[model samples]
Target: MADHRAALRAVVTQRMLTDPAHDLAHLDRVWLIAQTIADQRTNQRVLLAACYLHDLINLPKDDPNRHLASQQSATESEPILAELGFAASEICNTQHAIAAHSYSANIPPESPEACILRDADRLDALGAIGIARTFAVSGALGRALYDIADPFAEDRVLDDQKFAIDHWKTKLLNLPAEMVTDGGRDLAHKRVTQMLGFLEIFSEEIGHPLPINWKSV
Candidate 1:
């Protein structure tokens, strides 16, 4: 199993795209986070495999097939798992975890491994690193950092597709509320606060006066 992990790492190194957000560094980060929250009851092997292989395939954020990326990644991972000599049950469990980890997939995790993977990966989208990943994707997409006219989207309908900062109001701000475990939730709240602090300062810097603590729209 140890050798299999090494081999799987090699496979991903050879195949993963140069995606700035979902790169090998992202996988390693998620893997490390999973170890923190996972307990003795869960299958570390499946969770570990899912960690390494969840983003085995990457897609552009705006790609029409973005929602299908997780499913496709699961489909593509089967052969790789088999080649690594994963047993049938373990492969299927790993596949389930991978297929369901995407935010877009909306597939309820059926196992502890899936929950840990999803929770940990989503955590990567919340903190300072999350901000870096968001801006990286935005820059790569040639997106403006924010809408000058309505930087906080107070009156306008939030459209992240048009601006990067809109993503905080539309998605990132909502992550702390969705975390699945006590540890995940506690860390997420801290991260969310830190992110809001950044936004508050950024708003002041941009002279937008966008209210970071708006109770409502």
Candidate 2:
């Protein structure tokens, strides 16, 4: 499996034009996380290809075409997969995994490999890494860290597009429930706990205590 990844890694590192949050390092992390959650029945080749190419067409969070990025990536990966000598069926599975991995894509993962890839990709959007990625993306887009008057959206709408921290409430905190595998859910819960802990200190640092409702998992 490691040898299989080496060639794909080179290709991804060479060709992917990406944002800080969706760089080669992000692909590597997704591969590692996918391994942890992958069961015996999982196909390593399909998972590896999907993880590396999932963000081949990385789009900004605010892109009107953001929801289509995954599908585009899936389409784009076909030639690469064929070039890499992947069987037709393997390529099909890999494409499905890539296409179904995005939250915005809203495609249900029907295959085990797709489910694992989706969970793995979503896992990267939580915990400490998730926090860093959120801020990186927000900073790139010139979004504020949080609403100064309502950091937790206590009285206002949750708008992650404007405030980086609101992403935690808008999507990140709820990812565990969206996980496909039991192991993925378990790990997501643990990561959410870590994020909540970070928020506790973050809230205090900003001179506002975390709301009691959000204090625990």
Candidate 3:
């Protein structure tokens, strides 16, 4: 196989790519998460490749075209993967994992590696680190911390574009339910609890007694 890792690192560094929340460090974390969740049925190399290369075409959270980023990545990855000397099956497996890992893509993971990579990526989007990332992206976009009138989004249309807090209700809070693996689900539940605790603290800071009803709305 060709030296994809070396080639990718060179590309990332040479481009001076820097998204505070989705940079190489984030890839490292997701790779670790995948490694931690890897099973006998999973192809380790394919899964790891997907983890590192999935965000090769990352879109900003507020981008109107963000949902298309995954498939776009999959389409864009072929030449790079081919040049890396990936076998046909490996390239297919890696592309599927990358394509389906996006929450917005809503593509059903079709293989063990696909499911594992999906769970792994979502796991990275929960808990303390997830909080930091949410705010970092939000801040970069000039999004308000919360809606001053309805911080917890109890009585208004949730708009993560305008307020980062709405993301908790809109996406992050439901991630544990979406986890693809038993272990990933368990960890998601734990991380979501920490997120809930943080929400409680946020409510106190805002002096709002809003309660979370993620199941209904």
Candidate 4:
């Protein structure tokens, strides 16, 4: 079991390192944060593994073939896990966790490890790292930071507008509540607060000058 787990980790690490969007450094950060939280949890191994591998398959939001790509990767992952001799249960759990990590899917994770993995994945979308990734993704899609008005909102349409800012308002800010383990919640709350503060400063800077009295000491 130990050897199989190690082999699986190697495969995930290699794949993530090669992936362009969610690269190795991103996976490493998530795993580091996951370890800090998982230390207090019962299923650290599962959570850690899921954290590193959750984004193994990167799907571009604007790609017309996005759904097909995700399904294909999920299908491929099962065979890879089977070849690695991972237990059926562990393979299923890991796959489910990965599938649920997508923003569009919105599937509820089944286990504490899954929840922790999801939170860890989303945490990468906040603060400095998140800002870089957001613009990277936006640039790739040829999107400006602020569209004149919400393009998709007119049709009561679903679009990236909500996905972009809501990362700050919803998942990033609400992470403390969504976190499954106590330690995860504690650590997440601090980052969430930092992200919120960053957003506040960002909005003020871009929108207008603050009054002299409103300036901090």
CA RMSD of all predictions: 1.8, 1.0, 2.5, 5.7
Per-prediction TM-score to the true structure, in the order listed = 0.94, 0.97, 0.90, 0.69
Model 2 alpha-carbon miss at residue 42, Å? 0.5
- Displacement of residue 98 (Cα, Å) in model 4 is 2.0
Candidate 4 Cα misplacement greater than 4 A, ranges = 1-21, 39-41, 64-72, 147-177, 207-217
Residue pairs with backbone overlap in model 1: none
Q: Which TM-score value belongs to model 3? A: 0.90
Question: How accurate locally is residue 197 in candidate 4, as Cα lDDT from 0 to 100?
Answer: 63
List model 2 lDDT by residue over 1-217, tens digit each: 6766888888888888877999999999999999999999998889999999999898888999999999999999999999988999999999999999999999999899999999999999988899899899999999999999988999998998899998888788889999999889999999999999899899989998899867654
Q: By TM-score, who's the top model here?
A: 2
In angstroms, what RMSD does candidate 3 have relative to the true structure? 2.5
**Which whole-number lDDT from 0 to 100 does residue 113 have in model 4?**
71
> How close to the true structure is residue 59 of candidate 4, measured as C-alpha lDDT?
65
- The local lDDT score (0 to 100) that residue 17 gets in candidate 4 is 34
Candidate 4 achieves a global lDDT of 0.60
Candidate 3 stretches with Cα past 4 Å from truth are: 1-7, 212-217
lDDT by residue (tens digit), candidate 1, 84-160: 77899999999999998999889988888988898899999988999999999999999899988888888799899
The 10-residue segment with the lowest total lDDT in model 1: 208-217
Kindly give the stretch of ten consecutive residues in candidate 4 with the minimal lDDT sum. Answer: 208-217
lDDT of 4 by residue, 1-217 (tens): 3665567567777665343457777877787776666645436555555665666566676666565543354555777767766678877777776676655566777776767676677677755777677767666666665423432123243345434543344334555676666776676767666665665676565664323322221
Q: Which stretches of candidate 2 lie over 4 Å from their true place?
A: none
